[model samples]
Target: MQAFDNNLTSVIKSLKSSYGLAFFNNLTLQLHQLINADYTFIAKIDKERYISQTISLVAKGKIGDNFEYSLNDTPCADVSDDSVCIYPERICQLYPNDQLLIDMKIEGYLGTPLHDSNGEVIGLIVALYESTIINSEKIVALFELFSGRISAEIEREDKEKKLTELNLSLEDKVNERTTELSSALDRLRFTQDKLIEQEKMASLGNLVAGVAHEINTPLGVAVLCGSNIEDALEKLNSKVKSNSLKKSELEHLISILNQSEKSLSFNLTRAANLVDNFKEMAVGINTDDLMSINVHLWLNSLIGSLRPMLHKKSITIELLVDKNPPNFITCPAKMSQVITNIISNSAAHAFEANDDISDHQVIISAKVCSDILSIKISDNGKGMTDEVKDNIFEPFYTTKRGEGGTGLGLSIVHNLIINNLSGKLEVESTVGQGTSFNLEFPSLI
Candidate 1:
């Protein structure tokens, strides 16, 4: 009993300080010396495969290397099933066909099953001798005492290995997902920029088409008047060449010439005025430079250029500017784009629900108060609901998504007003009443 207690204390001390095959071999060696056994081993048993792996082995008073063998016809297999097995003096009487036992001349055998926390047999500890063991019970007791500790160590190592593999797998998945999300965000930004560029081009195309349409009328009139004047001059030259001129005939020719001159001059002046307005609009839309501009004069020219487009929709636009509104020093191109997007948006959406074309009106009024410039553009058409108003400025959000509305018009307008022009924009609307956009900006930016 004293020897058994001392052996247990020594094994516990060694196990607490060290680990791995060396620790297991040292433990088996200590057990072998204590019992005076010729052979001692600790084996892990795979019950399903009927295999035993020798974790630590000792023989002939020396430590032996670990190995594995079939457990089909071995005493270790029986020890795995039963808690303890002892063969004090077998002498080839039991399991005579067991070649390992015959070859090693092992007569005395004692083993204890190593059980895990769940009380399931997982391994065995065994001792064998060339002669019969005088104290078989003591050997079995010693094997049983340390079997649980060995099982615990094996289970702990297995769990730690699985946990390490799981942690590595989790980290890999997290990194992969993060990379995918970053790539997706980059793609989204690229697509957004492309869409914005497309919207700008489309707006410019519309403006060009409108200006072309507006210029056609006066140009046509001027051409007609010039043709008539040329025909009248040719007839007068023929009369002078013939040397047959009456006073009444000369007076009639002069009256006809006077009317033709006035018609030609009026039509030419109209054409020139239209051309000037279009030129100003084109310059404003293309240039980004900041310049001092008369608020009233600029608005008048912009409205004149847009009249052709408004007329096509049967929409009337009225502009009321203060007598002494302060001039603004800012980028006219960006402001023009902002205003154009707003009016275009109204023409496309605000009047779609209203059937009355006679009353369709867009009123633009501007005033200067202290250092601020305020512009109000209001429409007398079906207004918006709270939901539409809230998300109106959000990119890619629109009510007319399918019918050629890119939903970027208002988003561009908002960005231009806030980001480029450094101005503020607000909208007021009720479902049945009307819609009004209020714009305010510094006189100098």
Candidate 2:
């Protein structure tokens, strides 16, 4: 037992290196030389089988090729099957008949049970010969030393195999998760693109409404003035033919003609103003003016730009700005885009059930408080549901379908507020009441 303990200690030290297989082979050769054995076998056992385990070896002389044995036949089978180290004496009891050994062409056998790191007997190290050795105890002790060394090597080999399997499994799981995440991102981008298109359509719809209002006013006035002038000319022609045209009537006629001319000129000017405002809002060239701009000033300007569209829909727009608007360094073109998206959204979705346009209203207000620029846009439209509100800032969420409502309007507004202006946007809404969007920007921006 003391000899076995000493051998095990040495083997444990050698097991530190990654040469478990090489160590086993070397120990097997050493045992053959030390015991002067003709045949040596290193058998690893798993469950109730020997598994035909062996390493490199030396055959002392000509021996039969077959050395295989069933778990019930071998002298050391019991020791190999145990969960702890087993001495050679206990192994002898399992193969009590010495005749059985002789039948296998072996005079004597020496086996040291091989153990794993956890000290479980996984196999055995053995030496066999055609004749019995003279010094059996000395030979048994040397065989035990070799067994201990082989046991350490086997333990290391098992751990390496397990570690390899674990690494392969981890890599497989990481790849699967990455694929799933990539697919999800692609879907999100597709949805975002769709929403952006919707936002543009909404803005276009509002522009169309403004254009109609613009054209209608001038067109209506032109028709009225043309009709009145023609009627006045006919009355004068009739008076001259009947000799009823007097000096007082002539003077009055000139005054009436002047009024008609002024009316045409005034209405034409209004029509031109409407066209210019539309052009500026829709297709104006970008400007590089970096100035300290008043938040209230831009809000008012945007509301003015959107006024014609809302007015035509009878959607009353009201503005409440602070007496002194906070100034921020900004690009007006980008700011205009943000305001346009928000106001257009309200004009498109505010009115419920095709009610009179006049009944619907949009409010634009701005104030600077606590070094923050705050702008609020509230509408008396059919308000959004909680679910709709939650996803309103998401790229493609929209309630408008066929009317060319690109869900991107609010999304763009949100991005501009946050990304460009370094700000935040929030919304509050109640179904059947209205929706209010609050935008906050750092005064510095």
Candidate 3:
């Protein structure tokens, strides 16, 4: 009995931690060994409403050769109801010797109830022998002790299950919060970028308007003078029709008219060119979409677009494109933005106090070999200090802050070059002489 109690205690503790068919099967084997008996079975009340549930014999040792019984008529049912055990008498009544035992040659039996929580029996354990094994009150006491341990183990297992469910619920909540925070941050960044772009557009608009006013004044005066010359020509025609025109008078009129025409023509062409350049630089437009653009062509176009901005400060613009520029497919809008911003940076920062426009000169060039397109834009204006170059591409890091600069131009340019186009931008600068920007793009067609 001492050995039986100790092993039963251990097996109950193990059952508390496990579940399903495997737990019951092993429990039945342990119960058989504890009782020093052969043949053990574990059966459950598989349904709630049915009084008689099918028997599932989990482990069977060598005691009974074969046994059969009705689920509705078994000795184990009595113990299952009251958490007790039934012995040889009840077993004989359930399986009579003449009917069940004599055919099998002999019989003995013992069984204990297996309960779930709430003192409700879910199953029972049975042990069998081939001959008389006397039942005693000591045996009943042993069964009571084992039954209490099994109940405690089942309760502990249910608590552990609830704890596992709570942990999963808490983890899901944490993941949801992280996702929300990430989305909020992304939206905030997008709004910030929009504000910067708007600021740049405003600055460029003011510059364009000022330059247009200056050019229009000269153009308007030339047009007025041309009208006066036309009136003089009409007078000469009337005089000739009246047969009163002298050669000298005629020659003077013609000379005046010719001079006026040439002046007007030159001024108008200059004004138109200036207007075109301003429009190209000021407008937000992109061609080529995502086509494979020729690198040399793109370089020329980019310089032409920025020519007016450079001209405003008397910067001499020069292009030195390689003979063979490889074609590359990319977002033209993004590429144009990068070039415009870099060139504009020079216009904004490459000058110092009382810096003369005549001293400013900008040079742009490109070369291509195999699958690489390299471009360089340099200026001979007052260059940057080491400190400025270090943070040049940082958003809002400008020396010309109060001059209506948003400082996002270089940052946006940097982003477009690297993030959008998978390119790199490098810079070299000096305090007094000049600055240069080198950009490289892969020619991925």
Candidate 4:
């Protein structure tokens, strides 16, 4: 009962807080553990074809490939918008034609139908157990508790899919504007806001994911605290109703509420502080405001954010500068975008063909001579051709068209370096050796 209550509290909180593809994925994973089932899935029904397509599936405690199955002879076919079905044992024996059950050796089955806002049966959630299910009533209660949330999210996702398709046309229009940037200096400033928005969203996904993970702890605590307060209040109410309420029990409830209040406040404040960090990232790069920046500190901070993305690819980033690095006055955000673009570009394109793990390295070294702050970002991976290097900074001149690459990263970096930061950008490459990008900007901007 205690475990189920905690799990129920967590499921409700997670369902409320999550969005996007992650929403379904997390729910399926959680349900797999929560129900202690061998296979758990959330599926979208195709009533026309009598099929169910698993959007999120977990099998044997691991993420499994999504597939479609006919509901013609399966137990899932029996579930209606208002009907839930559970077979505690010998499900395969009952449904002799259900090949999936026989193949997977599934004995127990619990399926709850999902309904949209209009109360139409759109999908279902299924939990399959290899062993006999001992708690059918509990499973039914759990499914009943979350079926609405699941249905709403599925409906929301469908709407979002439509909106995303519509938004693609707007994105195309925005991409068209990017073509005019290199031709017009005035136009560059005008369209830069949109460009920065697109670019920041691309490079910052990993950062957002990391922060989301960090924020989850505090958010979970706050949710747990709120649950505790509700339970305490329930106990107090029950005692009052029975005329068994004592002064000590009332005082204990007060103490519980006080502790919960403190925990909720502290954890929520912590989550808010983590969110505040992202607000700094939301600052527009089009601003010409120059701020004093310690070169090494700024670079380290930028690299720290990129580390997660790099580490995923088994790549290493080395900051080859001393502790007493020079301080400069440059637009920090623009500088960040510049560095971010370069690192992002290198991360995506540089190490593609290199089979050697040890060779997957990006070296960033900076030094100040006179009033010029010169920085070099070099990648020890597959180098580019002279022709490719020449046109890399050109607008919309991408080598990765079919692979979702805009070819705008280097162009943005180029424009920011020359027009925004009063800097010179240069690139050098040898086919087999490596590629190097040198950025020289004014130190006292």
Cα displacement (angstroms), candidate 1, residue 69, comes to 5.2
Compute the lDDT of residue 68 as modeled in candidate 3.
42
Candidate 3 segments whose C-alpha is farther than 4 A from its true place: 1-162, 185-218, 234-246, 270-284, 289-336, 352-375, 380-408, 411-424, 431-434, 440-445
Candidate 1 has what TM-score?
0.79
Which 10 successive residues of model 2 have the least lDDT summed?
A: 83-92
Which of the two candidates, 2 or 4, achieves a greater TM-score against the reference?
Answer: 2
Q: Which stretches of candidate 2 lie over 4 Å from their true place?
A: 1-19, 37-156, 223-260, 283-301, 304-314, 321-329, 344-351, 354-360, 366-374, 379-411, 423-445
Each model's RMSD to truth, in Å?
4.3, 8.3, 10.1, 39.2
lDDT on C-alpha atoms for all candidate structures: 0.81, 0.68, 0.66, 0.83
Worst 10 residues of 4 by lDDT: 277-286
Worst 10 residues of 1 by lDDT: 277-286
Give the alpha carbon lDDT tens digit for every residue of 1-445 in model 4.
Answer: 8987898788778877798568888888887888899999989999988899999999988889999999888899988434689899999999999998999999999999999988899999899999999998888788777788888888998999889988998898888787666568777666766665687677667556656666788999999999999999999999999999999999999999999999999999988866664444434544667777777766765676677677666788999876776677777778888888888877788777446646689999998777678899998877899899889988778888988787788888888888878899889888777889999998645
- Judged by lDDT against the true structure, how good is candidate 1? 0.81
> What does candidate 3's lDDT look like per residue over 266-344, in tens digits?
8887777667655544444434346566666665655654666777777777888865665666665566667777777
lDDT of 4: 0.83
- How badly does each model clash, as a count of residue pairs? 0, 5, 0, 0
Q: Per-prediction TM-score, please? A: 0.79, 0.59, 0.52, 0.43
lDDT (C-alpha) at residue 134 in model 2: 61
Of candidate 3, the 10-residue stretch with the lowest lDDT total is 58-67
